[model samples]
Target: MPSYLSPGVYPRETDFSFYVKQISTSSAAMVGVAEKGPINKPTLVTSWEQFLKTFGGYINEGYLAYAARAFFDNGGSVLYVCRVAHYADPTDRNTLSGQKAAAKLVSQMDMYLLNGDPDPLPPQEVYDVFAINEGIWANRLEVQIENVGLSGGTFLLSVIYKGETVERFTDVSSDENATDFVELRVNGVSDYITIHDIWEPVGDTGMGTPRGGTYALSGGENGVVDMADSDYIGDPSQHTGLFAFDEVDALNLLMVPGVTTVPVINAGIGYAESRKDLLFIADAPPMLEPLDVVNFRKGQGTYTHAAFNSSYAALYYPWLEISDPVTAQKKNIPPSGAVAGCCARSDQKTHVWWAPAGIDRGRIFNALTVAYKTSRGERDVLYPEGINTIAVFPDTGINIWGQKTLQSQPSAVDRVNVRRLMMYIEEAISESSRFVVFEPNNPQTWRALGRLINPFLQDIKEKGGLYDYAFQCDEETNTPVVIDRNEMMARVFVKPTKTAEFIELNFILSGTGAVFSELIP
Candidate 1:
């Protein structure tokens, strides 16, 4: 309200409409190992080519690149990747110095005294070149420097990887004040390398020109030899590894490819439960028989003490065999990545409440076969224990045959679709109702909230997400006592739509003389 002591005419405007803005339910995140990229940082990649450009190509050490390829090949449009590596010096966690590859360039010119006497100092180092990340892949890179335009102050630098020239900079100077300074031009622009000019210039003459020769970068280590589950499940305070995703706001799915230890899976489930917005996809150990898998799920056999029971996580069985794009050979990998892609695909083709299984939406796009083919009896045994099986049929290829969370109890939320639907509705409504926080605790404000929420729930019900819903926000919920405490309250009850996981058919035989009309009853 504005006060006007003396006014002839006044104009005022007010906004009365409020609606819920739909949030995306398809974006995903992953924590894994890469050949080259910023360590413990969340990097966004939209396509397979962009991933290769940022993080190096395929490697034999980890399954990160393979999983990323499978994700893009299916239907995933956006992904946030966090690359992790073991520390070179575990005691020093403040610097990434000893884990990178670097080289130095020395001055080629000879200096003389004013009396025409030769100086005693030998050639000094001028510029330092380092790989953009910490990995052994940069060891194959070579930098070439050439004098340009008859000026000893400026030069051209060429970066070559595997004997192929990838990047070249022309007329770059060593002077810090120049517009074409090497550090200013190449620090954040070059995709492969970063430069630092460390030479001290003499009076008025930039005489520390680097020698025209090639230098090879060395001392790069991949840092995966001592990698452990603790490295992937890093400290939340430091924001490393899995905790690096804490900075991201709208992640809907999470995966740590090929790092499927029991401790790590348990930590992931706990993290997802705390966030209350995303689902964690878990993978079973590869190459287990049907009975062995059941025992593993039940904490028997080899896995004597390991078990999983959570509605925020789902366990997938049997690795997938896909043709290796780098080596042109078949490779067996975990099923979590492909399953995530199928979920994203389902969310795109239909609503998030729809089941992402069966033949229609659960087809594995990048897999040639499943590592272990399960029969009908095997699937029946696996599904009841809450292990979603990637089964192979004669003509249907490989498809996700079940959609069950790790919850051992039999309930509506034990199914993946119901749990995800509730999460979606809860997240959408809670985010949109923030506007009524400090408003007056009266019927007008309560009705305003109902007006904003009823349409959103009705829309979901129309889209086959709910069977029915009831919303109440009035004096009954926000009583006189609640008003005295400066509080507001509301309650919403909903019946979620369940998926059809089983079908039944009955067959009977009738006599030849029986009447068709009489038999119909």
Candidate 2:
């Protein structure tokens, strides 16, 4: 409110137009073992090349690199990758220790400062560089240093990887205030390594001697240990493993890629459900028969982890045969990565409410075949058990054949499309209604909420996400008792559109002499 003490006329302009900001629903997050990268840090890479640049190339048996490549190849636009490692694995953590070189100073002026006779603080030698990640890849790295034009305090540095110079710093000085101080210039900018420390010897021992030389980094080795659930579901307080994703703001899909153990998969499901904004795509263990999948879905399998039956998680069976990046030979890998990409593509081409299945939108990329040849009878058994199937079609190549959540209680959420549609609507409405938190509890505020939500629902209906919807926030819903308690009420009725997976056509036989109009009626 504004007050005017002495004024004939007051002019005011008020703007009341506000709209909901739609959340991004296509990003994905994953945690897995990698050959080299920051340990347990969530790094966002938008393209396959960027992932490789950060995490290195594919390993002989590692699937995270291959999965990341497949994700980008299948139309996923953004991914947050977390790398897990074992403590005993060979690493390059403290490989950069340099010895101090003598400094040029008059002996008389280099006495101890205790009696104010002189200041005696020797300069410490800083290691030129060390690998940014732990792996044999660092052994390919080389650091070269040289004096620049015989200058007093200036030097040049060059970093080489795989026989090619990747980074260079010219005229860098040991002085802290120099325009191109060696430590400041190379620590944060260079991807291969960071400058560890710098030092000089005491009392003119090695003062004028050039410490220019080329050195190769060593002590990087890939560990030989399998990842466990503890590695994937890292400590929440430390934000490692799946907990690393908490640092991220938005991602609507999650995949653990290679680890298909029941415990890890179950952990992923619970984590996804807790987040409430994304769904987990679980991959079945490789070579599992169709009967095994059915048994697994029915909660009668011999696996140690409990079966999860919820809309937040969906399971996919059979591995995908795709060409390996290193060998270019077909290799069977889990389908979780490809499934997530298809979901992203569907969300972009259609609405998130639409299922990412069938031939049109579910076609997978860079896939040669599936690990199993599923029959129609097998699909019939699996679909009812809430397992999404990947099958090969005559001309469509490899396609995601089924779309259903693990929700098997016979509710509308049993269908993936309906469940995701509800998620979308809930997120959008919840975000838009946040402004009503402290607004007046009068009819005006209620009407404003209705105005904000009805149009959004109408848009979804028009886009085929909803068959019909009604937004009710009138006096009847928010009675006097509700108003007195500082609360508002709204009832939203929505009939979500269902995907047509099966259709039956019946033809009736009529007598030859029957009239055409009568037969039609």
Candidate 3:
């Protein structure tokens, strides 16, 4: 209330309809190789077209692009893509460094094609330009500079790719202080190439240099030099590889396309466990047999990392055959991306407590077939070991057949939906209950805490997220002795609805024409 100096009437505003915040559960993160994007940077892409515009289309070296396509094709809404590449050489720097080297003024015409090195440094001044990203895709870029008779060292610059002019800059200058200076105009504007250097033409006679025409760029390398485990794990300090996703918020799912190594899998599983809300969707190695997959889950023979299992991780078997958008050829790739998409779609259509598996929710898009079709008995072996199966039906298409987590124990958390529901509830309530901190440690505060959490649990129950739930924050749970230590406690009990993984039907044959009333009874 404001200080009412000689006031007759005053009103106050108070909010009473507070509820739990809706924590996002459909957000997913993936880390892998890309041809042309900022390396080791997590870029948010909401649609397939946006992903294509930012990261380009599919390439043979990495399956991240294909996975992203599958994700969007199956109704996924949010994705954070992290691009990682193995730099083959030290010369593979970003556009800024290359531009600084090119900015060194000199008079030279000693020409070097893109990626063609050993060209002599220009004695005269010229501007050297390079592609904006590090990859072979830069080979398609070319720049054209023309002297348009503008005063004060002004000129016209055009950027071209694959015979099409993409960008045009008019009245640009070599003067660094000018408003339309070439570097200032193009550094953040041009998507294709950056101005690398500015130097004098070798034969310039002061009547203004010739147009200088067009120069095609080369020497761009994909930098995918045989990825190792360390490349995928990445450095947290440098924010490379998987650590690139540290910038993303509310990422509840993690997937690494085309990477199934033991160390990488262990790292991902451990990371999910650390986050407590993230679920790891694991992809099996390509060309492995069903028995091999079972053995892999058992951590036997050449397969490992199964020992690092938790309720946070779930493994899917067999690759998928989908047509390549670029080549239009059928190719087999990992199923982790499509599985992630199905999880997100399930969370969108139903609650996160609902299983993402089964015929209705597990349909994958752009899939032609599974690489290895498993039999009922094979899945019977795989499911108990916490390995989900991707099976192909005669008319129903490919479906995710199992829903168990990688927690190889006989606990309720082994079920995917139950585990996810618990995580969802914990995150939601934990965020909503922060107001209870530092309040009066009396019955009023305890009751208030219960009042805040009970409604959230009740909402979940109403939405079928839980079969039953109980929230306790009373005197018995937060006693006087406990309060004396400046500690408050709340206990939550939940019975999550389990999916019907197995069904049994019994039939008893009776004499023909037996009494219908007796049979009904």
Candidate of highest TM-score: 1
In Å, residue 255's CA in model 1 sits off its true spot by 0.5
Global lDDT scores for all candidate models: 0.85, 0.77, 0.79
Q: Which consecutive 10 residues in model 2 have the weakest lDDT in total?
A: 99-108
Candidate 2: which stretches are off by over 4 Å?
4-7, 87-125, 148-151, 198-210, 222-226, 474-487, 507-517
Measured with C-alpha atoms, the lDDT of residue 478 in candidate 3 is 79
Predicted candidate 1 versus true structure: per-residue lDDT over 78-181, tens digit per residue:
88998888754433357333277899998766665578666646667888999998889899988998874335378888999989999999988877888988
Error of 2 at 255 (Å): 0.5
Cα lDDT of model 2 by residue, 404-508, tens digit = 888768887878778778877888788888999999988888888887888888888999988899988989999999989989999999999998989788888
Error of 2 at 44 (Å): 1.6
Task: Give the TM-score of each candidate.
Answer: 0.93, 0.87, 0.87
| TM-score (C-alpha) between model 1 and the true structure | 0.93
As a whole number from 0 to 100, the lDDT of residue 499 in candidate 3 is 84
Model 1 — which ten-residue stretch has the worst lDDT? 89-98
Highest lDDT: which candidate? Answer: 1
